[model samples]
Target: MTPLKSGTQFSFDLLAGALTGRDAARATGTLHVLGNPGGRIHLRDGGVICVESPGSPGPDALLLRTGRLSESEWTAALTTGTRGTIGETELHVVAMMATHDAAFTVVAGEVEDCVFTPQTLDTAVAMSVAIDPVRLLQETSRRITSLLALPCSLSPHRDRVAPVPGADLHDLAPVREEILAHATGRRTTRDIAFAAGRSVYPVTIEACRMVTDGLMTVVAGTSVIATAAQPLVPLRPRKPPTRRPPTQMPPTQMPPAENPLPEPPEGDDGDDVPLPRSLRRQLLPKLFKQPERKKL
Candidate 1:
């Protein structure tokens, strides 16, 4: 299918123009938004049946979180109901909500491209409820406005969150507590919502409040990114090696001085000598000298 390029500010009119049918009948097909973190919207008979994206929480999340349904209940909805207890009405509501959130996510941010795949659905056994494209767009706008008004430190949908030190959990709502339980600083709001089986909108709103109350803190960038993964940069260069001068042999050693004087004769036993070693050395020549052999 040919990809339809979208502008920076994505609008409902733009999406409708690209995905609507010629006869104006319910456009039945899937709308695929292509980008770093893209989304998919399923239309049955011109009404939105389902919506999904990498960044937004899914329909199952909403139902499970709101206590509207359990994991088994949602699983049952997907089946033909031979053993599943969930009814068609509940499934349709879940799908409608999921689609609304998905559509908002798709058009709220910058879209790179879009593709619509035309197809038909067998509605005989399954319940299909269609949403008006115009209404869907309006709701998306309202959601965005609400999120902008929140006093959040980061984008609750994209930023990872963790509970702060000395967090007060005594009066927290059940939903907030659940979110806090999973706020490990590794999971984004979207991830926590998915894990808790709750909708992204409510979870995000709660997360924002938690942050404002100092119960939780954002771990990543404050703003949102288009892609699920960030781009990698090249490594930094290393420092250059240093040079050193060659070593030299120390100067040749010199012998120590000889003994200043020989030992005194052993028989001399100089009893008359009373001077110290130093004085004896000085006066030895005079004291031991004999009269010059009668030279006189």
Candidate 2:
């Protein structure tokens, strides 16, 4: 008989170890794999389960098996995880542990036609222990299918109406408009995205940025609370004067005029003539006006 490779034999031994206390090891039987690359194993108590290709059991089964799930536990975990649908292949196995009465059978296949025998024990254990390459491969296929069916995780960084940190201001133009529109405080990030015709991720990021920049305040949902104007400071009051009031003056009567004009000395030039009183009075007002104009 050809000796199995270290890696292949190792995997087989590891699975067998899990069945140490099980009746499968006590019963005399052969482990057989069919289709494509067929293989077989015969062991009495302390026998191990192995496969040429790890993919033989499928990804999900392999993961669970590798994770060391018990027979019943494996069944329960797989069932719960795959409650939705099973797309692709199936796992089938028949094992006689200890006595014929202790025989166990498991069939892990498409979600539509999954069949497990002896429901007395949970399906998890049976699936885990009886997993072959074929079943493992089918589990892997199912895992991929289930993953695809799940809703994508939403980006935590995205904000629809509020500005977020590290967001590009230029790209936020549409977000800004939307924020202004439903800003009536009725809409949320979802609402802003719907109204702006933009993705919720970018919109939310932009809104967060705006809030951080102080250009806008995030109120409830799509609406942003506008910044309040700062109040003006009042001028200081003037202090009252401590000095005494000025004295009142009495009115005076006009004095009688003497000579109307004085004659110039002999040989005096006309250039030395005194200016007229009326002209002097008019000139004073003009001078006062000029000073007032300068102050203005």
Indicate which candidate wins on lDDT: 1
Q: For each candidate, give its TM-score against the true structure.
A: 0.60, 0.19
Q: How close is candidate 1 to the true structure, as a TM-score?
A: 0.60
Backbone clashes in model 1, listed as residue pairs? 26-45, 26-46, 27-46, 61-197, 61-198
* Candidate 2, run of 10 with poorest lDDT: 101-110
**Local accuracy of candidate 1 as per-residue lDDT tens digits, 164-233:** 9887778877878899999998887767877887766667667877888889887745444433211211
Error of 2 at 226 (Å): 22
Q: How does model 2 score by TM-score?
A: 0.19
Q: For candidate 2, what is the lDDT?
A: 0.30
Task: Estimate candidate 1's alpha-carbon lDDT, on a 0 to 1 scale.
Answer: 0.56
Ten-residue stretch with the least lDDT total in model 1: 1-10
